[model samples]
Target: MNRVITVRELIEVGGFDETAVLAGETFLEKELLGVTSFDSPDGHKWLRPGEFVLTTGFPFLTHKESSESGLIKLIDDLVEVGTPGLAIKLGRYIESLPPKVITHALNRQMPILSFPMEKAWSDVIVPVVRYINDKQRMELVQTHAIYERFHRHLTSGDPVSNLIPLLHDVLQSPISIHVPTLKWNWETPPAMRKDETIVYVDKQIGQHAPRWMLNQPLARMTNGLFVRWLLHDQKVQGAILLRQPDRDLYAWEKVAIEQSAALLSLEMERQRTVSETYQRFRNDFLQLLVSGKYGSRHMLIRKAEEVGWELAEHYIAVVISVKPHSSPDVETWKENLTLLETIRRILSMCDLPILFGLDQHNRILLLMPATENDESAAKGILTDLMTTLALQWQHPVYLGIGRLHHSWEGIVQSYHEAQISFRSATHAIGLANAPLLHMKDFNELGLERILFADKPGAEAHALAEEYLGKIAQYDKEKNGQLLYTLQIFLQVNGNYVEAANLLFVHKNTIKYRLQLIRDLTGLHPENGQDQLMLRIAMTVHSFGYQA
Candidate 1:
């Protein structure tokens, strides 16, 4: 909304002629606050520098009152104050410009122009003001057009498919949208890529991109202005970023982008709510089936129908268990949720219907349709699933399978088999290379023997009494060195050199400790039975014998 006017424009419009004269000759085209007339004897003191000063040099320099020398001295003082130009009213003040003032003005290059006293200064100011006002109106119209296009797309109910195109059209630039997959890491996108298109919704936005699209020459140009929004309803499992090149977005464009992002985020949250509700229904249905609450075909069929299932097809069940090997504290419910989601995604890729349940025990049960394709493909699929889970989660996982059954009425049979396989895979003492089992291959009574042979509290109590007695004796004798030595020896498997290096002591010092252990406990670590007992005692002491 800024307007700069030139001196030539001002002169032509003001209708001034070239009769009035003085010496100095430069034109000052800067903005002026007000215009007024002044006399030379006032000595340019009332006026500041760099302003357009109007005068006729009349009253003070008239021939009867003042001499030419006094007038010339006044003009000299005015130039010293930085007056770059002067406009004079001629024929009313002096007959002509003083000779000395004219000479000095020419030498200083300060322009002096004359105007007929008949014209007013109003002729100069009005036109420039009107031009600036018109320019501002045009800028506002352009801003509103861009804002309207972005707002319309945001409210259209399909922001991912609609908003990017509207923005690209308005800005005249190509745009890309990416959504990330919850099952995989950020480097992979959940959905397929759509390029140079106007319509599409990605199932996974940021899963993967072409190498050319991500590397330099492209990413550097596009990613700098990318905007990201987290879909809060999805538990922060995914995000979306919008990218464009060539055009720099203005402040109004930034506002539009954020508003559209917020709308998309809300929609994603609504979808997640629906997904979670469906999952809860599936969990309740499976729990009822496994617990034998719905025993008859009629009862199971009615329940499945209520939950929106077709209810007449055969069902195959698979159970997956994630074991915590390092520490119980390391287990997380969110991680289990992610694992269930991944299994569901993989199963869906095969176009199968799967109902899954996850429990606090870190176990998942997937009840899928028992079509020929699924039954024939189950073994390879489950093996690949186990390997994928191990690689992705960086932990070992065990899976168990059950036989195919026809209809919801036979789900209990499959459930029993899956439970037995889960038990056998997890608890069988020395079984190696055991495939995921079917109901007939496993025996309920045999699993009972393996599962309940040792009560949890009995082993804990025995280890506690043995390890606690040694700790008490060591504490009373004021000899913590023996406990420290025993811990290090067991840690190194009785290697004298490694244990000594760990303790930063001579190798003989560790040998002396082993001798001292025999003196104290009357057990030699060189004996296999004694070594096993001591190792168990040390492990029990470290975890707290009380627990």
Candidate 2:
């Protein structure tokens, strides 16, 4: 770090040795960055932050109320411009400053120092400017050294996590690198920020000037915490946060932090590229694995092993079919991409080897290791996985789990079974009426296997129309919800109260709808045979409607 000269330090310099601290003694520690001697009446207007000002006090001599408010106002202006201190030759400026001026300067913490009349302004300005210039030169050298060190780390293939200690060494402060979407962290915090705030930060991302260093903080959190955004392609990909440092960071330290952020951004881009390539290969491998096209099963297993998949004695296949939200505002592709990424991150933490990839149909596919013939354990794992995934998504995302299968061909069967389970459920009941997240397992499918395993042909469609056509026509003509009510009633298994509660209506309404359904289809609501037939017709009708 380059040494900063403070107002107190200026007193020790050769030209400033005879200066007396007249007021604002508490702010003698203010950093002095530049010095200027201006006698113009409007000279205070041109003053900058951290500059030390000097004069014969001649500017105040012409003030109408030079001994009072006019002097106080001048002091206020100097303080507002953030001048480190004002050094005045008091004897030459119409005797002395008013008491109010000193009181105001002291209150504002604007240092007021005095020098003898013989002290030339050049004696002060030349040495201060030289000192500042020398410090800046040293800072440039230090900044370059830090940059080279980071460059060496980047070329040496060190991971971003390893670079944290190097930054800690330079800053002597707690530092963290956070990529929240990726759930990657080098240190403790992921940073506390609202979603909209993050979006705003992203909008402001660009190549900022060096003056932004230390002067502008990306985030204004408390406890001296600040951040530098990690940008990739002009987008904020992540951030590097510095917390509770001994003091504010200097320009060179900020430069080092920025360089580290650049390195991290580069690493993220490289990882993303590598992940994309790996995903393509993984997708292709999964397609081939489930297609049963490979000649040698052992070779296929070896290939899976190479990709870090442990082909257990038994494994269950899971298929997740993403149903796009009904809202036009939702982007289906972006939603699915976020869902898949969330799944990948959560599943990566599992103890058992779980392989994930997209099937040929573009549905998410997972082959999770399981014990031989233990369907319950696999279901438990799938349940936990689905529950975790559900918490991350706002809308319902459906999943189908196949029975555990052993051989390569069995893997294919398991994959198909998984796909069929979810498709069957969707055909039976629409996505809107589904739970927050839907998980259907093949082993759990009973009559649904017979009801939805095959697509209903024209004959099956006709049977459904024969039973439901009258009610459907009634709904279309009258804008009635009898069909919807009947569907809900059947779903609740003739529990009038439950059905009514689901529809937000009275039980009598459900009974009335049931009677109307019976009158239309000539089927009794309480009769088992009639109920079964109605259900089959409804399922078939749903399948046809969706198709």
Best candidate per TM-score, number? 2
- What does candidate 2's lDDT look like per residue over 110-140, in tens digits? 8878876778887777777777778788888
The lowest-lDDT stretch of 10 consecutive residues in candidate 1 is: 181-190
TM-score of each: 0.43, 0.65
Whole-model Cα lDDT per candidate?
Answer: 0.55, 0.71
On a 0 to 100 scale, what is the lDDT of residue 426 in model 1? 65
Off by over 4 Å in 1: 1-161, 173-243, 246-249, 295-302, 305-308, 324-332, 345-351, 359-362, 372-374, 427-547
Which candidate ranks first by lDDT, i.e. highest? 2
Q: Give me the runs in candidate 2 sitting further than 4 Å from their true place.
A: 1-32, 48-50, 61-66, 79-84, 91-103, 106-109, 115-118, 153-165, 172-221, 231-244, 292-296, 325-335, 349-352, 373-396, 403-410, 424-547
